[model samples]
Target chain A: MRNLVVLWMLILSMSIMAQMRDFQVITPELTGTLRLGLIRQNESLWLSDYKKIAAKKNGTETIYTIKHEWLNKGSIRISTKPLLDTHGFVMKIETTDIPASIHLFWAFGGCLGEVINLTGDENSLKPEFCKDNVFSIEGNSFTVYYGTSRKLRILEALVPPDSDVRLSDAHQQQTPLSFFNSGKKNDAPALAALTPLKNNEAVYFCFYKQNPKADYNYFMLPELYKKGSYEVHSETQWMKSTPD
Target chain B: MFKPLLIICFALFVGMYIKAATYNVKDFGAKANGKNIDSPAINAAILEAEKNGGGTIYIPAGEYLCYSIRLKSNITIYLESGATIVAAFPGAGKDEGYDAAEPNPDNPYQDFGHSHWQNSLMWAIGEKNITICGSGLIYGKGLTREESRLPGVGNKAIAFKECHNITLRDISMLRCGHFAVIATGVDNLTITNVRVDTNRDGFDIDCCRNVRITDCSINTPWDDAIVLKSSYGLRYFKDTQNVTISGCYVSGFDNGTAYTAQWETDEPQAPDHGFTVGRIKFGTESSGGFKNIAITNCIFERCRGLALEVVDGGHMEDLVISNITMRDIVNAPIFLRLGARQRSPKSTPIGAMRRININNINVYNADSQYSCIISGIPGHCIEDVSFSNINIYFKGGFTEEDGKRVVPENETVYPEPWMFGTIPASGFYVRHARKILFDNVRFHFAEKDKRPLFIFDDVEKSDISNIRVNGIKVENPFTAH
Candidate 1:
């Protein structure tokens, strides 16, 4: 009986591990890097050429910093620092010498499942429509909840905002959002549109996931946190905690 | 370890056997947020599907901001209910507009907008077997309505060039910059159950073949609701053939009120704009000519009437129009102009216009000034035209002085119903036509007008029978010059 029980547990654990992966987002999953527009112009950057990436692990926590620089044209520099826990991570972004509206787009690969809106309302945890403050995704067997420290704007696709497709002045029409490759819908990756970074400024966002088995309680948390201010509870403590 | 390996192998086998996969744009990073530009992610998902032979690219419900979306072969862009693709606002800077129209040497042959496909919010060129279908909305908010000869604005909601086997169904378009849809040199096209409410021209099928437009409701205040053209823009003289437009409803509303349906029940009448335009037409651009066409079962409300023009040195023949109902027509209910604008190359002389038939047409409240005209140039008379079972009501208020007015022969000018000003006749005017026939035709007016029912100027080989004026039989209604 003891041997049978050990074998059963081993199979169950293996299956569970296969079903639910540890919050390890490989390099490709987070393919987006920081971009700095020196002249405040609209141009896409190659993520590999401009990124400086580093990561450190301490106990059960990991810290990552990614900085990018553009030396010529406008001499722009931008950086993203993320503190990752088992559930998810929190990131702080800083930029310098951005002359005009500069955009940074990122994708969390396949980690986030089917997306549902978080209509912050009084009946639920968050009562307001935070531009894009909170959302939910379906996990392997349950719904997982995610919340951001700030109201992040989400985009269905990454198309340059100012591109025009009008060829003639007949009737003098203007098409502002033109496609680079026509007829291929949404060829660019889906990403979040961050608020434009100024010459010297930083914005903070916290991304934390909640298992639906645990009622979504973090909706009541405030947006915008300091560097290293968001702390994740240890596994032993989280396992024993009750609903707030 | 052996068990894990077995499981992995099984998974790989299953993955390999899957015939085609459904790719959600969300998986590729499309945020359905109302304001984000979603064209890139949606395009990426389509390309991914194309890479895998061909699959469905599914778009869930949300407002997706998009620019131009390139379409590939063997793909269907499926939009879930309540999904919308909105045009983004023109931000600062000139390059921020749509990709500049590709410079083609044939551009001088046609207007700037008709010469290229790149200057549209959604466009396909030289593609095959593509479809955009859903019970969704495409709102062209920030697209430009400016008519220009330059390449710096977006003018069309959807444009196609040299494409094949395209289908657009069950979609609604609102405020579609200039033309809601324009297909040039496209073959095997099907557009059904679509609605277009716009301020400018609706659908323009130019130099296309095998087109079927059915069960559509179009309201445009500024221009023609549906038009067929064969312009020299395609560089080659490809005749438009095998077209059937039926079971459709067309009308005009105020400049910006087509989508709101305000013209139906409420809203004060804005006749200054709506009454002047909005009708079905075939060519002001008849360079390549038209053939094998049938238009039937159409209704026109509160707009201009039907017009057929073969002015740009192209043949207009073998056309059959039937079962048309029109109300509140601000101009002549039926106007056919076959002129010698001579928009042909030096080697090509003017072409012929003949063999046209119109039947089962009813018009009410037609404008009083210009009667329905069938006109051709002095020497080149239109040939073999027939009209049957037609009834028209004119807004009678003309005096004897109006009856004596002689319509001019504006041969080379733009072809419009009102281009000749007031005509001498109150009902039908046939000028420079041969072998003309009218049967079971009735003309009436709300008030008494002392004008002839039919005036023929240089007409030849005509037959007129069974005509009525104000419910009374009139004998010899024809007055020939």
Candidate 2:
């Protein structure tokens, strides 16, 4: 019994130690460095480029951004925009934290490659792809980063409860199909009013929708943020917290 | 005996061809009286004839006063030469529920109130195939300018709503107070060969469809000489579709601000443009949209704002505006503002303006301000825009040094010298647009502008070709800062 108790404590300590990862974000030049703020589900948080990924927090809202990173660090990429095969989801984010980096990962049903965003936020990134590919995107966050592995930059582990799609992941996600892609619009105005924020009221905004019309899709971004960038203000985040 | 029989038969045939009835205002011992002739008499005559199987209600040569009158199917209200129908005075309703339908009521419109309507001296409701054609005069007693000063309400004129397949031709309407003649939610209507003179809007159309207003001369002071609107009323409405306003001459105190220059109605101080659109938004009262709208071969002279607006209402799609000629405009020669404000608290419809096409537009001698502007929401651009053989000018161009103007003589711009306000955008200004294309565009300035005429705010996937400014190819306006 004594031996078992000691063994359990040792195992617990080992798991905790593994969580203390050497999560350093480095430029390809091995020059710029940034400390990452992370809470991990796995080793998904330790990326090589901080500019390629960023976090934005607005009290209850939190956004995660990942750039359309690919190819060698500091090298131009002619790759397609990031997308998924099962349910192709993409987003773009704009930020300045990245020095130089590109993150690309592969799990494929085919080869359309990833959606690459050259610049800015709020994009419906569509890239030509062939057969099958599985991907996820930050949707509307754009930031600067530098690296060479072109490894995957997963955002789910970083985003808060309600993160908006990044520019790199523009069209929600392409599953076997996308309904709104048909474009047979609605007649009655759906709504897209932007009441200006009074200087004193509040900066953070929130919207909740359930089943959007089959023919229409909507996206909302603050005036100040860049594509693929949650660096300014986190736009939207979905939390799994209890109602209480 | 055979000849006698033939003559009797011929007489019977002639009797069959005679008009069913001939009732005149004079037949009732009615005189012009210079006062508004009660329209009930004429209406009674018309209804009587209809009951007797539909005929003509002749308005002979005389000066007559009149108020609202309705016509049914298969009826003709003919005005002979020298006849005149003077409009009833505007009803006075310091209160909200005053019906413009009845003439003599409490606080009658001698002239005052915005809540009032111009139910046309000769009006009709929800019926079909009616015609009002004549060479006589119809006097719509406009407010005497004193009417505009009334605190809340005041618009005197003739207007119609929800009547269809009607034609109004060869008449002269004078000094209308509100809208000289207004029509809404009606279809298959045509107005031709009419001359309207007024301080109010010459003709106003809203949420109406299949209308044609051609070969008319409209002169007004307030808004569009002939304006089409999609407004938010008691219901969010699409007051227009498939309308053709061609071969007409229009001019206002300023350029018409119909959907083009001004589409937002946040200001509560004024009636907005009689020529403006979307002052109200799409919602509650609405569950549909507007499609296939065209404006071609029209002339807008010295107007305030020109062009169609697919504002922030829910959705305005498939618009084709072309072959437009504008001269001496005060503000923008062409403007498209596509945004809506959900002013109502109800389950108001939202924005969805899409699939638009604007081509073959020409503008000249607009004021020193900007000439053309186009903007869309962030996700949706003013898409597939192609300007072919287009020519626009800002008349007098501003200099970059205008920002540095010495104002050697003391003008505001010259003194402070940071003239940020001197140059207003350009011939083409795209904001938050996607997939836009520009072909064969010519933006001209008075020889001295050193900068390119195209200014893009935030655009993507855009292609430009055959574009010239001051007869020179477009210089790159984008540079690394």
Candidate 3:
């Protein structure tokens, strides 16, 4: 009976940890549990202005399809599929009614630590991060964010290829949740402006619980044979074996 | 009327023939879905192109798992974007893997990988006007990084021997075993816009002439990025001459991280338990020599720095280097060694090192354990080397005892900086050298260091001027013998 109780307590702790890591919409404005916010501009439509049209499961993926009516002309449809394995999500927006711009804002409780822009630069040895919490991603396709909190969390945003998208850290003034609540309780949120998506487009955002480890053998190359399996012949031996 | 009809017929025939010159690998029964071995199909395409007096073998966008793709003369292998050639592992049987390493009678002097060229993913011997280009990837996923006599194992990614008029451009390589590209006894080589993130050496230009390497980014955490060698593997003393390397970036990042753009910095040390060894160097295998080489506008990051060595029995001369910048250097920013580790036949004498000019170098966050070393053997001295307009910043916390440490002359050993521990100088250490000049050189230390700025032992006819240490002017024109 005592061992059963210990096992139950272990299961309870695991459940609590998993729940804490789960990303969900915390506010009506679609503020994620990890402080990721979505804002649609050109009259500023939030998730609260949208209506959930459908939710379905498709092959190990739960996709939520939502729609927002803008100016009573047409409704924009957004399909968000959470990638459980990668701890990320892909949002596909399809509509003829294109907004002026869409942006993903991060309200990290004003605890943004470091931001690194990795684009065409592939020199891993000398990586340069932003200084003084100020960064510009003018010509970058990807960016990584780290929080100053003790929790080991990282956020990455990647722009889709061949898209007319620009990533920036500019401030967005749309809603109250778009502002970071520092200890002072009022600060501008870090913003990434992905402007002018076409009729159908998608973007990916990954919030990792921990830093991803680099895979040394990413292709799974085979190991070499042991040293004892072969003998290295010397010059004298090779010369003797050859016919002069 | 008959003559006009014959001319029209000939024009039509030529147009059709030109259109048939392109051989697509997919049309030749290559299942490029990363499943089946596609080397046989690729080789068949190459043979067909060669039979038609040379043509282009086009590989479209897919993953092709291959064993060995033999190269032929007058043929070009063009890979389209999103095309990847993955090296396939050898099955457990004889002749089940890549082509066997052909027997090399002149294999006594060099290592096994250098002695043979057949046992590789792609190889060419005695082929001219051959080119491999296009924005594709060569992933050595099944090649071994070790020297093994196993029947079904391959080592090198691309190995060329005795070839000429070669061009390799716009290709990216990852995790290439032993070497990403090794060109031996080849002439008129041009490599540009090639990116390689590998475990071992990136490019080994040995016994070649008229080589140009431009705009290459190579990252090798455990080995040299680009090393020029003149080994006796060809069984002849052919000097590597008239080479130029410019606009290159080399680094010692973890393998594959450069491609993925992750930039993981936790692992500061290499797997070999030495300092990360990704830098530009010349010779630990100088059997013939290097001449008329120029390197300019290069960058080094988180690795060793420029190393010019002629340890084997050869002559290294008439070299010029300019416009180099380094950051987070793990060892000496400049190492020039002329030693007597002659790994040649019985009658070969010691090599010579002279006539090297280096200018406009800047280094930051360098290790204080080793200063810039300019060393030679006891009886032989390196001659006529000059350094100008150089600046270096070191992470320093050395004591007086560390400054008084004695350096050993490992004459017959391999040439590397860490072979001698804790050099006594914090700026420069000179031994057995002559006609050396340091002009407008400056050194700065992050922490307190007790070593002198310059230490000379057996140095003759050296001129040091406009040298500063920690923003303070040192003795001007410090000359010693």
Question: What is the C-alpha local distance difference test score of each model?
Answer: 0.63, 0.43, 0.69
Backbone Cα, N, C clashes tallied per candidate: 59, 115, 0
lDDT of 3 by residue, A10-128 (tens): 12211121111112321111122222234555333334323343444344233344444442344344334433223334344445554445444333222233332323122111112
How many pairs of residues in model 2 come into backbone collision? 115
lDDT of 3: 0.69
What's the TM-score of every candidate structure?
0.64, 0.53, 0.66
Alpha carbon lDDT at B109, candidate 2: 9
Could you give me the TM-score of model 2 versus the true structure? 0.53
- For B343-371, candidate 1 gives per-residue lDDT tens digits of 54556556667888999999999887787
Model 2's alpha-carbon lDDT is 0.43
User: Which candidate number maximizes lDDT?
Assistant: 3
Better of 2 and 3 by DockQ: 3
lDDT of 1 at B17: 54
Q: Which structure among the candidates has the greatest TM-score?
A: 3
Off by over 4 Å in 3: A1-244, B1-15, B476-481
lDDT per residue as tens, model 2, B1-481? 9999999999887776454565576665547666645566677778877787766778888877665566666677778888877654433233221123322121110122212243345555566777777887777552332222222222444445567787888877766555666665668878888877564567766667898888887755343477665544314345467777667766553212321343222111112211222111111112234566666677665555465444424456676667777765666565554444333224644455556666786777766544455655455455555556777776755655432322121111111101123333445555656666777877777645533355666677787777777777765532100
Q: Between the candidate structures 1 and 3, which one is better when assessed by lDDT?
A: 3
Using DockQ, give the best candidate's number.
3
Supply the DockQ value of model 2: 0.01
